[model samples]
Target chain A: MKNSWLALLLFVPYIALAIDTDKAFEDPEMQARYEEITAEVRCLKCQNQSIKDSNAFLASDLRREIRRLLEEGKSNDEIYDFLVARYGEFALYRPRMSGKTLVLWIAPALLLLLGGGVIVNIIRRRMNMPIEDDLQEPTNT
Target chain B: MSRFLLPLAAFVILIPIFMVGLTKDPSELPSPFIDELAPDFTLPSLKDPEKTVSSSDYAGQYALVNVWATWCVGCRQEHEFLMELSRSQSVPIYGINWRDGRSEALRWLQALGDPYVASGFDQDGRVGIDWGVYGAPETFLVNADGIVLHKHLGPLDATAWERDFVPKIGGGS
Candidate 1:
C-alpha cells in the first residue's frame, strides 16, 4: 500500500509535466514559429495567460489558426497583423508603439527621470545644510 | 509644498482615468472590425448542409449576426430575446453556430425557439476567428452597406438591445 502511494505521487508530477503536442507542425522551423506566436499571444479568455499556457478553447483555436497561418507561409509580421486586424492590439502581449500606446511605452523611463530629479534635489539640499555636531550623542572620550 | 506638487498632479490626472476605467467592462474587448467591411464567408447552413449561407445575404439590409454554441450558457440566457426579435421582424437575425456539435445545436434551436433566419455551421470555429469571436453570444451589427458597425459581447438583453443596438439601427426596432 505504501509503494502504491509513492507511485501515485510520482504519477501526479508526470501528468503535470506532460507537454501538449497535438498541434505541432512537421517542420521544426514551423513548429518553432508556432511556439513563438502562441507564447506571445494573450488568451482573451484569461487575459494574463499566454495562449501557449492557457487551456481555454479560444486559446486552442488560436493555436490552430497559428498552425494554419504558418502552413500558408505567413511571416511573423503578417501573422501578427492578421490577429491585430481582428482582435485589436490588446491581443498581443508585446504591443507595438502607436498613438494610443505612446505614453504606455515611455511611462517607466519618464517615472525614473522624475525619481532621479527628486533624489538629486534632496542630495543637493543636504550638501548645502551645515552638519550639526551637537545633535549627535558625545562619544566616550 | 513643492515636494507634494508632483503627487497632487498625478492624483488629479489618475483619478479621472481610474474612474473611466472602472466604468468599463474588462471582458468587453473592442473589436477592430468596426466600420470596416464584415469578413466575407460562404458556409453550409446548419439545418440543411446542402444549402449555403453567405455574408452577402445581409446586404441591402441591417442585420444581427450572432455567434452561438450549444455549450454557451450566455447563448441560452439570451435565446428568448432572440426569438422575440425574430418574431418582431425588424431585422433578420443570422447565427454562426460556432464550434459546436451539429446535432446538439440543431436540438437546442428545436428545444428553445429558432430565431436565426439561417445559422451557419462553423464546425471548427475558423470563421469565428475572422469575426474576432473570443467567446460565445457575441452579436455583430452589419449595416446595409455590409459594414460592421458594432460588436456586443455577452448575452443580449432588452436593456442592451435598446441602449446599444437600437440607436445604431435608428430606434425603429
Candidate 2:
C-alpha cells in the first residue's frame, strides 16, 4: 500500500502531461514505449528544449505523429528507426551509441579511468617511500 | 622525485580538466542563421490602422531586427536595454511582435517606450515561422546588403551588449 501511494505521489507532476497522451493509454506496453521515445527526441525549433517541454507547433505536430504511429501498432524500434532516417541524429538529446558518436559515449569513461590511474600511481608511490621516522632513526645507536 | 612528479602531473591534469569544462559545446554553434539573406515578410503594425511593414524597408542601412511579444517576460526585461541600445547606436531598430494583441502591445510600448523605427505585428505567428523565429526575444543584426550579420538568441543583457554587440558593431557604452 505504501509503495503504491509513493508511486502515485511521485507521478503527480507527470499526471498533467499524461492528459496530452490520451490515445497512448490504449495499451500499457505502448504507453510505456511512447513515454520512452518522446523523452529522447528534441523539439527542432526550440532552443535546446525537448519535444515534451515545448508547446511549439512543431512539437505538437511531432507529438501527434508519434501518437498516430503508436495507434498503428508500430514497435518502438521501428518508430525510432523511422525518425532517425527522416531527421538524422540531431533529433535526439541523448544521442544513440554509434561509431560516429563513439567519442561522446566514451568521454566520461575515459576521464574516470584517467583519474583512477592517477590515484593508483599516487598510492603506489606513497606505499613504496620509506617513512620519515624510519629514515631519521638509529637513535638507539 | 616521485612526490614532485605526482603534484606536477596533478596540476597539469587539473588545468586541462577545468579548461574542458569551460569550453562551450562546439557542435551547438551560435545561431547558424547569421550572414544569410534576411528572410522576407510583411506584417501588420499593432499600433497603426491597416499599416504593414516589410524587410525591404530597411534595404540600405544596418538594422537591428528584434523579435518580441507583449506576453513574454523577457521582452519586458530587455526593454530598457533596447532603449539604451537605440540611444547609443546609429542603426535603426525594427521589431517583430509575435503572438500578441494590438491593444496589449501598444500598452506595453506606451508603458515602456517604443525603441523601434517601425514594428511589425505577427498576430498568428506565421510571420515568425517564415523568419525562423522559434520564440520571442531573438534579435538579428542585418548589414546594409539585407544580409544578417549576427543573430542573438535569448535576451540581450549588459554582458552581451558590452562584450559582443558593442565591439562587433562599433556601438556605444
Candidate 3:
C-alpha cells in the first residue's frame, strides 16, 4: 500500500498536466467546427504544431477568438480570411492555391516526373548497350 | 555527362534557398497588414473604462500601436524603452492591452509610467487579432494616412527604433 501510494503521488502531477480543460462549445456542430478550424490553423508561436495541439498562450487566444467568431455566425471561410488578413497565408496549415503558392504545389510532382524520366532513360540506354556473350571463353583462362 | 551535371547544378541552386529557409525564425510569421490601412477597432480605454477609443483617433500623424499584456514577459522587457520613447514626444504612441485583466494592466502602467496617449483595453484580444498580433511586444508603425508603415515583432529597443522606425519616418526622430 505504501509503495502504491508513492507511485500515485508521482503520477498525479502528470495527470494534472495532461488535462487540457479548455472550454467547449455547447453546440456539437460548433464544437466540431472549432476542432476542424483549430486543426487547420498553425500555431505561429509553435510553427510545427497546430493550434489544437499547441499549449502557447497565443494559440489558446486564437482558439477562443475562433469560438467567438463561430458563435457570431461567421463561416469557416470568413474566419480563415480573418486570420490570413492578420497573420498572412502562413496562418493556414494548407496554404490556399494562388499564383505565389503555385510553385510550392507543383514542385514535388515536377521533381517526381523529372526523376522518373531520368530513370527510364538510364534503363533504356543500358538495354540498348551491346551485351557481352555469356558463352565467351574467359580471357585469362 | 551534361545530363548528370544538371542534377548537381540544380542541387547547388537549392542549397542557398534551403539555407535561407533554415535561418529564418519560423515563429515570426509575416503580417499581411503591411502597407495596408490599419484595421478599425473600438475598445474601452484603460484609464476610463466607460469611455472608448477608436482607430480613427490615430489619424493625421505617425503613431506606434504597441500590443502588450500584463502576462507577457516580453512586454515587461520592452516597457522601459516605451517609457523613454514616450518622453521623447516624437510621435504619439497607442496601446492595445491585449487579453489582460483590466486592474492588473492599469496597475502595471501606473507603476511603470503610462506611455500611451490612450491605452485601449483589448480584454478579449479581438482588436489584437485584427492588428495581426501573434505575440505581445509587437509594434506597428502607422503613417499619417492610417496605412501601416511597418510591423516589428519582438521587443523594440533604441537600436531597433533607429534601424526599423527611423527610415520609415524619414529620420525625423
Best by lDDT: 1
Residue range B34-141, candidate 3, lDDT tens digits: 889999889999889899988889888899999998988999999999999999998899999998999999899989999999989988777887887888889999
Query: Order of all candidates by DockQ, from best down to worst?
Result: 1, 3, 2
TM-score of each prediction = 0.88, 0.57, 0.84
DockQ of each: 0.76, 0.10, 0.66
Tens-digit lDDT track for model 3 on A18-106? 32357778989989998999999998877888998888877888988888899999999999988888888889999898887789899
Candidate that would win on DockQ: 1
Candidate 2's C-alpha runs over 4 A off are A1-40, A43-49, A53-141, B1-11, B15-29, B87-89, B124-135, B153-159, B170-173
How far out, in Å, is residue A52 in model 2?
Answer: 2.9
RMSD for each of the candidates: 4.4, 8.3, 4.1
When 1 and 3 are scored with TM-score, the better candidate is 1
Candidate 3 off by > 4 Å: A1-27, A133-141, B1-4, B171-173
lDDT tens digits, residues B7-44, model 2? 79889999998898788653342443466677788988
10 residues in a row with least lDDT, candidate 2 chain B: B24-33
Local distance difference test scores for all models = 0.90, 0.76, 0.88
Per-residue lDDT of candidate 1, residues B77-146 (tens digit): 9999999999999889999999999999999989997999999999988999999999999999999888
Deviating ranges (above 4 Å) for candidate 1: A1-19, A133-141, B1-6, B171-173
Chain B, per-candidate TM-score: 0.94, 0.79, 0.92
